[model samples]
Target chain A: MTQSDLTILSNREIATSVYEMKLGGNTISIARPGQFIDLKLDGFFLRRPFSVCDLENDVLTIIYKVVGRGTEHMSSLTAGSVLDALIGLGNGYETSTSGASPLLIGGGAGVPPLFMLAKALVSQGKSVTAVLGFNTAEDVFYKGEFEGICSRVIITTADGSCGIRGLVTDALTEAGDYSYVYTCGPEQMLKAVWSKINTSGQFSFEERMGCGFGACMGCSCETLCGAKRICSDGPVLYKEEIKWPTPA
Target chain B: MADTRVTLCGITLDNPVIPASGTFGYGYEFAKLYDINCLGTFSFKGTTVLPRFGNPTPRIAETPSGMLNAVGLQNPGVDAVISYELPRLKEVFFKPVIANISGFSIDEYVQIAAVLDKEVQVGWIELNVSCPNVHGGGAAFGTTPDSAARVTGAVRRVTKKPLIVKLSPNVADIAGIAKSCECAGADAISLINTLLGMRIDIKKRSPLLANKTGGLSGRAIFPVALRMVYQVYEAVRIPIIGMGGVAGTEDVLEMMLAGATAVGIGSANLVDPFICRDIINSLPAEMDKYGISRLSDIIGGAH
Candidate 1:
């Protein structure tokens, strides 16, 4: 909630419509892998929430897509501009839940956070396997980083332009024998993963959010118990707790 | 060790930071991220006598320096809230919870308030007579002083708890509406729910939001909200909960100086869930930085 004029450490296109920016804010130094920061972009009222892509020292890395007005304005920001950001938000993933043999799955922009999760697991002497998904080779991101940390890294694209042709689930199917799974992606792909995997897994769900913390119930999903706010209770939820929206 | 406490309508809150209605969702979800009780108070989603599906999706659209939403007061209705939501709320929150009630008619307001008044956990009742986003319902009741007064007077007859009337900013004379609510027995008034706006997708060649027009909120609306609050504060004898596009403690101080007894943070909470908590923690230290003591002492003192 602290406000700071963060200098752009690096803002560059990592994939088609996807970008990575390194911001100099002290808040970034304390950010965990799964937590996010809301960047107040030029000509936008609500700050855009981006997951902490990577953090080192005072540099906070955020990878985002130019999906709306906020990100569109963010894309036009140059190298030296100072932006106001609300950093260190939401509950990041807990490593204790990642078993000795764990599989990580990420799709599109979702692949960024898994890179940090892989690094954390490798440091703990855990065997890590990752499946990174993209729609095409140009859309693919974070291949080298995952390769550096995980024992095996599988890449999948919808078009036959990259690693394994087809979806991320196809890539995951190729690499088996995982004790636990951690995934983040579009709801449909997550539902596919949920259906195929019998093992306990952690998932991150995206919703049209207002007040990304617990304040607005705008981003709510029904569960067996009742409704839960996705931003606070989770952008991350245990697989069993999630009640998917039935297809229209 | 700092003093961050304030009193709203004689009800003591640990701080003046309340998560506005439609934002805090009864306080359970935020409780998972941090202690819910740490907040001054939290207002629940607007509850009506009957269930509501809300407006159509593509319900939200991003605007320059703000966003537009047509989330037409979606709730599981008042009875479901009392039966289902309240028990869950009691488990997660210990702080004061204000029930924000909305209705299409006068009797609906009374029925909902009467139900909430019996619940000891409900510290106050906030009448939502001023949401501009909904059709045939919201902005209609709020745009006219007579209708707003009628609704308030009807609810006042049934409820004993302190009542806060949330005013719509779309009205031409907000001061008249404030007077109407006060005359109708509203204990306090919260002004400037989202202003109405619309957007069209250039490529799709159609309105971006399904509702066509929606309520505008965020930093862009701050000035408009402040001006309305100042006008309404001058006209109303009761307390004012000023809200529009409050992003920080500085904005909070500005609203208070404009004569708001307390302020509400709406869309800013979406950007950062920890904002209320951050503002709460930073207030005293921020006040100290300005050589101020009590939050009340700082209110309306800005010249």
Candidate 2:
């Protein structure tokens, strides 16, 4: 990963409590689709980690929610704000392994990373299907964007104010005949996705991290191969290697 | 020209900046960022006899000027360190690395220390008597002078290499603990291994860290660590590896004046992976600005 000062080209709220920020910096470090960036905010002690939404030339796009003080402060920023960022962090998605038809599933904040993956799959001439879930119609974002690239785009809202009235699984039957599944979302949603899909896939996981690199061991995840670090070992993991925690 | 050389336990380090244990991992991550040979030496992750998965998710929390982590000594165990980590560290780091060992009992410490002492890559065996994050193990021996001394003496018997007992600051008398380790044959004392602290997620109305509490480190702990280093300096005859929130070169120089023969950069490495390299590159200039020519002369200068 490379560290560079990125200039915030735009910071605007895209959906309810969610934002889409475009930063201008060196895209040289970003190699894969699912890799993230850890940003050092001005007054925060720990860096805020975000998945890369899109990378066009030198301008990088990221989506964040104002869940806490850090992202709230991030939402207040304007153009020309310089942020010290650790670019191209975490082991991102392995797109080459994506087969003929890829099923990209995402929920809420998890939707952003799939945008880049969708773009990648489309460029590879693979027909892509995107299943996105949100709390409501207002919480929905990038639906049109995903529709523009994928052969089919499915939207699910918990409140039924949007597309299908349920979780992304409620709309899964319509997704129909996909070769691979790539998903990122809340743990419960991810767990559901893990059990519902029969196809081989990759999953993106999140944990409270210490050093967004591999040093601190704060973001350890248990897998079939013992425990691994989520920051360096992965924010993404193969579906076969996943070992979900037994329910209490 | 500013001189940044210092001798710790008869071994000469090019500089006094050592990345604190648990912060630098096995020198693998930072090696990808910049050349790690420039660092004096970094203390690797806290290794135990058997592998530990550590605390659960949300193992960390952010506070003002600092962060709290309950990593609970998560490591690949001693065997993996010898077989995998040390070999990889050897490839990138040319200097001898410090092995920071943690254990639940005296035998565990003795076992791990004995094995590491045989490795040529290990320069010193840093006994982590004070890892506040783990339960019934890590910080247990460090909270008391007798326990700290007992662990130090046990490890000292196993390894002829210089022994540095890392002391926790959560006790009543940090100096007493340092002196006890010194009297027990410890070659040096690394003070202030994170004060136990915790945070609450108001939104969830529960503790932020999975372990409930964690060791606090960063700018917030600097003054407390400095005071403890200054206190421990007057109590122990051995050298002091002063740490706890040492970020910049000024902090390094300040730690030296507080009686640290060598300084450690911990959470700062998490903030900026290249901080140690940058500090070493700018040490001479920062020293020049302070009218100091040789860093060795400034050891306990404030005293």
Candidate 3:
């Protein structure tokens, strides 16, 4: 991992409380698509961890939602503001395992990392389809961005204010013959996807972290192999080894 | 350049900066970021007789200039630590490490401490007497002088290496506890383990940490730590490893003046991985600024 000061190229509201920030810095250490970045914000003791949405040249794209005071401060940052960030954190998605046809699923803030995953698979000559879910149309984001790269894009909202009119699972039945599933989102949504999906897939999980490295074991999650730290071992895990059985 | 070296329990350290246990991992985590040999030494993760998966999720909560952790001492058990972790640590760190062990019984403490004493890399044994002694009605051993001295004497019999009784600040009488441990043959003392604390999520209408409570550490506890170190310095003759919210070099000097032979950086290491290394690097300049030629000369200077 590399610690570098990233200058904000742009930080703007994309949808409702959601924001897309472009940071300029050395992106060579970003090993894979699903890996994340931990940002050290001013006035905060713990550094904030966010998923990497896109990376091109020296510019790093991250999408975040204003969940608390930390994000609230990030939203007000102007151009030329620099952030100290621990870049290329956690194990990202392993795209080589994605078959010829892969379906990407995301819910709310979870949509950001899949956008990068979709781009990675598309570039690998794989046919990519994305299922983007939100609470409502106002919370929806990156629908068009996914549409630009994926062969097809499906949007779902819980309130029926958007495309599929249900949770992400509602649209999965007709999402075509996708060979694999790669998803990121809230735990409740991930549980739904874990049960609904039939194919072998990968799921990216989030946890409140300390250190955002291997030291603290603060972000550890139960797995078939053992208790693995989400920050370093993964924000991404294969569907089989994930020990969190579907909800009762 | 200022002299940063200090002698602790007959062993000389490069500086009085040892990364506290749990925050530094096995030391290799920071070794990948920078050379860890720059540290005086570090206390490895808290080990137990059995592997503890630790507390449930949301184990971390951010407070003002500090954080809370109820990680339940999630370690791979003592046997695994001896075989797996120590081997991994050997490749990255060159200095002898402080083996921090916790227990629910005196026998348990003796079992682990005796085992660690045989390991060539263990220079000191830090007995974390904060854990509830299951046999003692679940009250932490460090909370009372009797239990604290009991555990210290039990482990002291097995380990010939320097024994540092790490005290919990949750007690009503910390200085009394320190004096008891010293009487029981503790070679040194480390004070101010995280103060017991918790936070609530108003939206969820429940606790923020899954365990409901956690130990508070970081910049928020510096003053309290220094005070305890100062008090313990007055109560005992053993060396003091004072830590709690120590974020910079000035704080290190202050801790030494408060009678700490060493200062440990806990949660601050989580904020910036290179904090201990950076502190060690800047210590000389900070010492020069303070007009102190020797850090050893400052131990309990305030007293």
Candidate 4:
């Protein structure tokens, strides 16, 4: 919510296409788990949105992928660089309402936000089972971070280059008794989870956005009730409210 | 007290800066970051009669000093908007919210305006007569003076609210279209929607966007936007909402001096969410420095 050009505390690559960056912005320091910051890299017209990985004091940690030009420039910056960011966006996950033994699913870029959710859940004396998905073994990230906070941490990769060869759903062992499920990933993966589990959950979708905030209706999702903007009402939506488009 | 007040088309704005349609969703998202009511007003994304899925993938591409978009007016039909977006917009923003309306036909424009006419929250209707990126439709209506007049006239009959006709920069005779909108009963004219542009993938040997063409907006389009605003201002008596590549308060001032009653922050909003606020905050000081008290006193005063 507050805009301050903070310096980079540290920027290091952890896995393929993934890097952990730390900034000194106070706005990001107070950012909740599910909230994201829109970052402006040099020479790009639009700011890129990144979720808060961790925060302490004036320092803000974010794990990001070098997917496009913006991130590519973000990757090249040194420790002294400054970033103009719109921090504290989207309503984060509500921890108090979540039931006991919540099932957490995160794929690739989606994994960063769940770290905070896991920390929040465990602090409240609740058991969390996290399933982290990546494309290949080398691409895996935050396995250690999730393991530190959760009772059970499962890892999945499509090529069998890592833990389970199939997908996050492959790691859904035991009965479908999870109190609530929270997931973020590519559309196909979300659809898979949407179909397999009839239980209630929360979903975060990625859409091409005009303004990372709600001004542009560029990133709108059709819900069961009606249409809602992902940037404003939610990048997170209750499972029941979503009307997943039938694949053409 | 902050001198955060501006008037356009005889309508008073709390401030002159606003997030352009398609950039600021429904005025709710930015409300989370800052008090949205602190500024002038907000314009919602384009609405149509039927829900449009928008253009295919690669709908947007960033070019040097600008960006291209082929969004294809993706919206949840006008009826759905009145039922869904309007109620939500009413809850979040207290200022006037301009509903941007687009259509494939003249009747569609009337139908959409009629639906909006019933909603008192809607402060104005911005007609997208010349969207260059759409296929076969928008540019056609915008390029011809007759077509622009007909569309504006049709919508004018359905609503008593202020009508602002958005112009396209692709046309050669922009003044003709501006005059046409004025004659067609338009209350005001918003100029320079986007210029028709294309990009090539040197490595892939194909066009960059799936639509093969897109509307270009950003810093590169400013001069063109200013010139068109000047011409249109001279051609018509209606107020002009100038937009192209406004990034700062200085740009806003320049746009106003060139005859823009208000300015639209397009690509600049994408780069910095605080740009609009920066312009709004610095306007009074800028006026003081220039020895001017009222923004209207300097309208087209640069010449």
Top candidate on DockQ is 3
Ranked candidates, highest DockQ first: 3, 2, 4, 1
Top lDDT prediction, candidate number: 2
Angstrom error of the Cα, residue B240, model 3: value is 0.3
lDDT of 3 at B293: 96
Query: Candidate 3 lDDT, tens digit per residue, B1-303?
Result: 689999888889999999999899888878899989999999999999999887778899999989999888888999999999999899988888999998878899999999999999989999988632122422378888999899999898998999999998888889999999999999999988998889999999999998888888999999999999999999998899999999998999999999999999999999889889899999999988888999999999998
Per-model CA lDDT versus the true structure: 0.81, 0.92, 0.91, 0.81
lDDT of 2 by residue, A91-203 (tens): 99998887999999999999999999999999999999999999999999998899899999999999999999999988889889899999999989999999999898999
Global Cα lDDT for candidate 1? 0.81
Residue A205 miss distance in model 1 (angstroms): 2.3
Chain B structural similarity as TM-score, candidate 4 = 0.97
The interface RMSD value for candidate 2 stands at: 0.8
Candidate 1: residue B178 lDDT (0-100): 90
What's the DockQ for every one of the candidates?
Answer: 0.31, 0.88, 0.88, 0.31
CAPRI-style quality class for the chain A–B interface of candidate 1: acceptable
- What lDDT tens digits, residue by residue, belong to model 2 across residues B24-109? 98997788889999999989999999999988778889999999998888898999999999888888989988999999999999
Q: What TM-score does chain B get in every candidate?
A: 0.97, 0.99, 0.97, 0.97
TM-score of chain A of each: 0.94, 0.98, 0.98, 0.94
Candidates ranked by lDDT, best first? 2, 3, 4, 1
